[model samples]
Target chain A: MSATADAAGPGAVRFALEGRITAGTAAPIWKSATDTLVSHPNRPIVVDASKLEYVDDVGIALLFDLTRRERPPEAKVEIRDLAPNLATLIGAYDPKKFVPPAPERAHVGIIEQIGRATERQIEYAQQMLGFLGNCFKAMGLALTRRGVLRWGEVLDVATEAGANAVPIVLLIGFLMGVIIAFEIGLVAQQFGAVIFVVNGVGVAMLRELGPLMTAIVFAGRTGAAFAAQIGTQKVNEEVNAIHTFGLDPVHFLVLPRLVAATLVLPVLAVFADVIGLFGGALVMVGFDIGFVQFYYQLLGAVSMTDFLLGLAKAATFGFALAAIGCQRGLATGAGATSVGLSATSAVVTGIVVIVVIDGIFTVLTS
Target chain B: MTEPSSGTTQMSAVSVRGLRMGYGSRVLLDDASFDVARGEIMVILGGSGCGKSSLMKHMIGLYQPMAGDILIDGESIVQARGEAKAALQRKMGVMYQSGALFGSLNVLENVRFPLDQFTDLSLEQKNLTARMLLEQVEMAYAEGLMPGELSGGMLKRAGIARAMALGADILMLDEPSAGLDPITAANLDRTILSLRENLGFTFVVVTHELQSIFNIADRAIMLDPVSRSIIARGKPSELRDHATDARVRQFFNRQPDAALEQAA
Candidate 1:
């Protein structure tokens, strides 16, 4: 429990340390050493531990502090004849206080930044293609194998993504149709062509607006929901757990959402089209156009080709939205921030993909 | 640090040297070092935000240390990459604080996870192994139940079973009985002790529960927030009784040790 200091010679001091070196024992020893060092400022301190019995983390910490103290440039501290276990303990508990500086970054030109961006976009494209390919393979497997697909989960997702979304989709569609009819009727009245207002609303709602509006609604609602659900799973390591089980998350998670969205989007689009036409019919009756004339004109203007094309586009858009949302979720990084980022990116990517596919479809059809 | 002597000498399951841990520039622990001997249950105890779980995470390779290296079976996990890293990872299984079981998977399937990933065991063999591990944890009756359907104690048991799926030599558990009742926590401690005695796998458990510490720990290390390093290390009872540091004393005794505040 005691540390005895001896003045061996000028400019040198030796301390023989014995018994336990613990929190209780080290404090007195530390004071004695500090007193000795203050008396002989320029001397080299030698601590002999050959007779020491025990040491703990606190004891090791005290020794480390002693070794790291500021002293004269020529002064040194040394510990000798330490027991193997004590030495190991000291080595293990000693802290590395100095931190290395971070590596310097090289300057980058604009071209390099552009090149990096392009490379990132290309990589992202490749990943999306790979994911789509996996989805197709999973869908194929589901078709070939009777029980491989989680039909119950698919139905659940369908009810959630489609049936639950009906009210909002119909509301937005009806409002859009009413607005288009009113705006066109205001101009048509000046030229005595108010009857033609029904034609304008009918073409827009049936061929383009119906599917596009439904897809956008689903993207914001269901796609974001998919991202949030899967992102949370990723953060919780449940996704990793799935991987650990030798199961494909894309097959188990993404496939169900994809199947549900694709199956129900066309139905939603058809519903939106009917509701939007009814809105136009409401406006048409105000302008002295009968329900029969409005119905006849809507039928004449919107053929089966336009209606089927819109449904087809709705299905494609549904697939795109689901793919983007699930992909964002599956690719989520760790943390709470990443979950929000996944949801945000899912909506953005889903909308962008929907718009691009819609443009391509319009060009091909026109 | 030099490698421990091999063959005749007892080997440590995990060794940490000069560990500096923190986020970015904010250092939480400096000069952290310790070792868990093979087949020993080492409890990491600390006050809240003292980096107990952080230290465990570093040891299990969840996050890289700010400085210093961790070695498992004398191999430096920090320096290992690719196959070496994967091999090292395979030797250890981590049970997260939340159990982290796949919600979609039943208890049996959760336990079979590691086997499915790393082994060529047939479906029947995997199921049998999963059931056996579940039975060891007394969770066999809940084999068909989902994680969301389990109680706190049941989740912990199921998590332990899943962690044992691959027969990993080391298990790292982050607060195994954190939210359990006293009776359940004691039962978990007994389960851990018996598992250690039977399976001979080393465990590194991060927890602040005093009873569990005294019950299950072969050796324990207490992390001090003020020091930002280990302040005490020994058998839990030995530390509780003989620790000379007031902070250590305060911790084990569940005291405030605030004489100055009382006087004021």
Candidate 2:
């Protein structure tokens, strides 16, 4: 098929369309044809289709482009010697469709970007406050025996977030202990104070690394899972479904996870502490300290205040991770991608909160 | 309309044979068969929880059926694998219920995506073509907008534009007018008719909107979840008036009828 412009006759510029005109065929000549057609603005379109065999939507679109662009309303466009079938086919598409259109969008400057980020953070804080209030209300109901805990779900979450996480937690704790003991003992050896490394490692592990390392690992694993689960449920309207059943989503969904995490974290931290001490002792043997000497040094260096404080921090960190994960999930906006973003945000925010809480604890103790 | 099929796949654009569709142990469509003729708009009609959408998914090779063959043009999509399945898929375009456009791309980029994948056209040419298509669907004004920013009607229009970009002969639309206002729904029906009448596109639409069915369907088949098979098939008018099944009659009458129990 070919589209050629000819000034043979007066009324309007004439173009003869021959053979087939489809998306496949029209694509090769479309640029040249439309470019040639637009050059004659004042003249109307005259389509000579005496040899035309077929035309599809794209071909029809070509004719519309001719009539709609440049030509005045008073100008006349005509089709001559067209077969009845092709005539009927072209009649279905109206030429007025492409009168004019363009896409418009505003630009966001750097200042606005910063402002928007700040606004988002403020909104997040406000939402978390409300979530915290709802959590306390649910806890009050449970304590008063007005609301029953779904223990089965609590145990299931505990198994997933607690028992499944043991290996990784122990591994991190052991590595931290070994690295700290090795670094401190190497520096203290030149001063004939290698035994001080035992005291240093002992106090740090019990008071800081055990709870912090376990909580960080849990934040990445369980926090993201909680967010994804709740976010997906929110996206699928399952949260709304719970509301329709006259049950509080926070009480039914968030509380079980919160309870499970808080219950299991201290137990996991105890495992971390014992294994960490073992790892430190293994490294301490190279410093000429016997196992009994290392154990006694650790006992002298650590206090009941430090042990109980670490347990409290572990439980608090667990509560924060579960709460942030569920909050991020319940904050889901729309669509599947939104659920993914919620999960990512949950992990990131959980870690940040853990560090902030740790800093506050250090200040209060000092 | 390909002379109105007499239960044969010989002249059909899309043919489903011995199809069994369900989830796990629960069956929704069992040994179901239907034929959609060339260049005709066929509506898959059924009540909620029926297998209308599942049947469409099977045709597109998204869901594998228990036992069936979905023939697109002349190829069996159920058995076609790798490039063979993709080749058969290129002949058809599907618009999902939610207008599931790629989340990251803008409207124009979404429409141009198939062209970029399938054609060697220059970037400028592809953009112009995509714009023309968006104009055809009355969506040129929102070409820069993201899928998340669009309203329901706009999303459907942008979806139609993207579907048409590939020039697939068979277009399958699921609930095109579900959340639309009456005027917008009617406009969508008009767009469907324009495409079929002008471009000779064959359509398999899954919708229960009474107005939409009468507006565009050349033929329709009704699925009964209870029977787990198609209970009625014919031109929309004929099925509405002459179908002997009370359940079919209950649907067409649009009111509670003494002869039938509600499908849901």
Candidate 3:
């Protein structure tokens, strides 16, 4: 079997004897021959007939049995590189010839072959399109199917992506507002226009910075959580089980988190804006801008449109997180290594998509 | 579709005809045909890569057949949809080899899943039904524990509990005893028998476990590993008596003494 396994790599075994052959030579040769054919059935094998080996009728019968009327063991086997004259006695040297088999439809022509390849390419394109189509269908199902609200999962994502993230968003928002207000207040005072500091901080936070900064924070936080959660499920074959149960995994799993994040993010961005504006108000008031007047100017500069725009951007960022997280997780196969790879890909892809989408919205809204 | 005539001779739970399945040039099942009767536990036994799971998948309508018809209660599963598929699912319960309980859900939730999804049962009703099932499978204490917290035997029992949640008339258990200890395996078989006795549901169990086969199967079908064909199907005693095939005999020799006693 080992010898056969080694030699069988290229073909099925075959031999021919022209003179008196005994079992002594035949047995070992038969072993090697059957062993070779047994090991690698798919690869083509050829027995050289020009060596003029003679054999008895029994050895000849064994040879015939080995090559001519042999049952190919369970795998596809074909004999190739046969000499024409010996091929007659060897009975065409085609293993499939003896095995009654279904005939395949023949290729039409050269042009038709190319057309077939082109058709295959078209088929692949259709497959990819169908996969994407299914994704959209899943999105639609997500909207319609009311998932059993997993409060635990919600709190888990919240604790990990939201609560743990508050310190950073707050710190950044407060510092940025204070720095801008202080710098702008000094510059404004030189020109006796210190009132403008409130306008500067309010405009920046509400129009652009608040949403962008918070999304970037969450791009690190909840984005990673989504990847880890879904990736682990994929690794454990939990996703496959969902499909076996006739449930759309995306609708049951991804949609709730997506809805939660999308809803929560804009609210977080608004909170960031409020804190940032207040921080700026504190610095501006120290620079002789009256508290009431600073509040008035801040309100005037930051309109409902500004908050709405930031909310819109935050929503876009949310979509990016969900898409990247779900895509990477679904792409994962069953292993811890695959899950790790998926997590990294999720983060990278989420950040890229978020930035790209943010820029697109900024340009369009501008 | 053959309608079940008032409890005399049970109609076939699953009937497959001219079943031809292939992936690329590799044909797995070629013109395979078989019928499994109601209340008769049937096992599709085969070695690794012989398409036992694939055939089961087709039977369950997970993978569409390449070329053939699968009749579950006389309606082609391939042609089944909407209410038809839903009807089929409601009629049949499946337990995968891995005991695929949803990890996020605890044992109770896992068992309650089919009821919550398919039944109009209220939350309290679902919970009560789920608890009843867990108790039936002897996993009532494990109800609050997640799938990860359960042992292999416990997981299999939990899976079985979930399978029975909908009170499916036909249960399809794939490798239900694959990874369990001998005691656990025997317990699982006992549970299966109890389900049959109590609920009178038909079962189609796919497994290589001879112990399970003799313990639970009313009729066994041998899927030849080499030929990739159904070489024999009959009562285990008849298979032992009439089965001249070397592989079939080899399978019988390996059956546990408990299975043989159960068969007797």
Among all candidates shown, the one with the greatest DockQ: 2
Query: Candidate 2 residues B1-264, lDDT tens each?
Result: 111113545468899999998989998899988888888899999898898898899988888899989888877999999999988887788888888888778899999898888765566556666777787677877888888678888888888888887678789999999999998899899988977865678999999998899999998999999889999998888888888887777887776755465543
Please write out the lDDT profile of model 1 over residues B89-168, one tens digit for every residue.
Answer: 87887888878887667788888877677655455445655665676677877888877678878888899988877666
Tens-place lDDT per residue, model 2, A213-258, is 9999999999999999999999778999999999889988999999
Work out the TM-score per prediction: 0.48, 0.82, 0.45
- Provide the lowest-lDDT 10-residue window in model 1 chain A: A93-102
lDDT of 1 by residue, A1-366 (tens): 678899767767998777765433455676676677777678898888777665532344445545656678777777788765545434542233211222245899999999999998898889999999999999899999998889999999999999999999999889878888888888999999988888898889988899999999999999999999999999778999999999999988999999999999999998899999888888878888889999988788878899899999999999999998999998877556678888999999899889999999999999
Give the 10-residue window scoring lowest on summed lDDT in candidate 3 chain A: A1-10
Q: Which stretches of candidate 2 lie above 4 Å from their native place?
A: A1-28, A34-107, A133-145, A148-153, A182-196, A238-253, A283-291, B1-11, B21-30, B106-109, B119-157, B179-181, B254-258, B261-264
Full ranking by TM-score: 2, 1, 3
Error of 1 at B220 (Å): 1.1
Candidate 2 vs candidate 3: the DockQ winner is 2
The runs of at least 3 residues in candidate 1 whose Cα sits more than 4 Å from the true structure, single-residue gaps closed, are A1-211, A214-223, A226-366, B1-7, B257-264
List runs of model 3 lying over 4 Å from the truth.
Answer: A1-366, B1-9, B240-242, B254-264
Candidate 2 clashes: the total is 0
Worst 10 residues of 1 chain B by lDDT: B1-10
lDDT of each: 0.81, 0.83, 0.70
Tens digit per residue, CA lDDT, model 3, B1-264: 011123456568789898887577677877789898876678888666788888888898888887989888787888888888877766677888778888777888899887677655445445655665676677877877877677878888898888877656678888889989998899889878866654456788889887788888888877764675788888877776678775676577776446645655
DockQ-based CAPRI category assigned to the predicted complex of candidate 2:
incorrect
Question: How much is the lDDT of residue A316 in candidate 1?
Answer: 97
